[model samples]
Target: MRSARRQYLLESALMTNPLHTFQAWLDDAKRHGVHEPTAMALGTVDEHNHPSVRMVLLKHADEQGFVFYTNTESPKAMDLDHCPFASLCFYWNPPGRQVRVNGRVELVSIEEADAYFNSRPYLSRIGARASRQSQPLDGYAELERAVASEMLRYPRGHVPRPKNWTGYRVIPQMIELWKERPFRLHERLQYTRTGNHWTEQELFP
Candidate 1:
């Protein structure tokens, strides 16, 4: 019964602009206190064409692209440098919805990254400085020491965004939205981007 009602609502939304429907769904998730509402699994390929995936927080999204922040020198960023193609998968289990995006990734303008960085909490800015993501940690004590050192350096005043940390925007070529339904059925809507327009189609599941 619940799944049926959700399916009905989702189908109605998808009948309209699927992008609008997705933003509405994401807004609902944010309002309903879904932790990490914009968190998505990012998939990318390295130089040798090996696939890798990791959870990344979505910082921005619009008709233009989907954006996330990361250290520019990180392994993922290095992979993105080599191969700009990537994918994002967002699953909201409580809402029984999933959104998939496949696209070419690009670094957002430095100004844009700076503005977003300025908006982040001071501690987060400091934390960004302390973390060397994906690097093998010597120990918890070592991490704490780094944090303490950074905190002392910043001293509750303004924290500058690290030069290495910035944002990447994924310009989608394909976007797919799915909603679970009863009796093993599901509603799937896909949008394929071509030039300035997007073509929408429904898929059987």
Candidate 2:
């Protein structure tokens, strides 16, 4: 039974585009009760080539690639401005599956950012306006005061999207998927994009 299951998974991995396959796995993770199923570790490099990584939520994903939103003035955003290349990694322990994506990053359109910003919860929008992301704050009280100030400014109506808050899309050049197995012998599949098509291959465990 274990052999049959492994074979099935391998076949499935080769049968679809990596983005679609990743979405399927993400859905399974959600169904299996994995917390923060959309969370991914984002890796980026600064102008000096220093690498930094942090966990970010995967807000969108499709044929174009993965998308996430953040403050344009944040450290990660600064790194992206200097070096647009990035990598994203998703691991779902409950399903023993992982996905890795490497690509170039680009800012989403202003219209896209506006739409998403409007959809955010009211308090979240206010918080985005209040925080000066990646900048050193005097203290917790300072942050609280900023939030309070933003609340007063917005009052009861729509909170406009901050100019520095926006979204980015990672246009993937390569994607890799891995499934765990006994004794550390794992199944690995990789897809590399060329022009409009993707070439798929299996890697040694």
Candidate 3:
């Protein structure tokens, strides 16, 4: 029964335009009440080839790729500087669906970063200015003092985007979609990019 379900999913899967297909699945996940549907696990490697993974919100996704923002001094940013490759995974348990992406990371344009930063809430803008991300914090009081100081400096609508806070875009080279079945049987479909087009193939689960 489970194997039949898996086979049906494989036969019905979309095999072109992985980006559009991903967006459709994401929309379904959202409609299914998946918590934090845009949240994904990002994996990066350091200069020593040691891997690190963390959860980050997906800011944007389209034909170009996925985008996420962070402080330039953060550990993830440092890892990106040393190595430009990254992998992202999105799982929606309610729908028994997962998407995996492997890509090259690049910094977004200054204009793009500034626009997104300005769209953020005023307090978030101030917090971005106050916090030195990935740095060791002295204490809770110290952070409070910093936030207070920033609040006084920026007032209400005058907070500007921090120089070191920016966005990164992951330009995907490969994308894989997985669907879980009733039993252990699963369906896996992979799409690999070649120049301007993508080639799709099924993989053994």
Best by TM-score: 2
Largest lDDT belongs to which candidate?
2
Q: Residue 87, candidate 3: how far off, in angstroms?
A: 0.4
lDDT of each: 0.85, 0.90, 0.89
lDDT of 1 at 167: 94
lDDT for each residue of candidate 2 in 1-205, tens digit (9 for 90 to 100): 2244445665545455778888889999999999999999999999889999999999999988799999999999999999999999999998899999999999999999999999999999999999999899999999999999999999867999999999999999999989888898888878999976988777777
Question: What tens digits encode model 3's per-residue C-alpha lDDT throughout 51-109?
Answer: 99999999999888999999999999999999999999999988889999999999999
Give candidate 3 regions above 4 Å deviation. Answer: 1-7, 10-15
Count the clashes in each prediction: 0, 0, 0
The alpha-carbon lDDT assigned to residue 57 of candidate 3 equals 90
Q: Would you give me the overall lDDT of model 1?
A: 0.85
| Candidate 2, superposed: residue stretches over 4 Å from native | 1-7, 10-14
Counting only residues 3 or more apart in sequence or on different chains, how many pairs clash (N, Cα, C under 3 Å) in candidate 2?
A: 0
Q: Which parts of model 1 have CA positions greater than 4 angstroms off?
A: 1-10, 14-16
Q: State the lDDT of candidate 1 residue by residue for 93-180, as single tens digits.
A: 6678899999999889989988998899888888899999879999899888988999999998678888899999999889898877
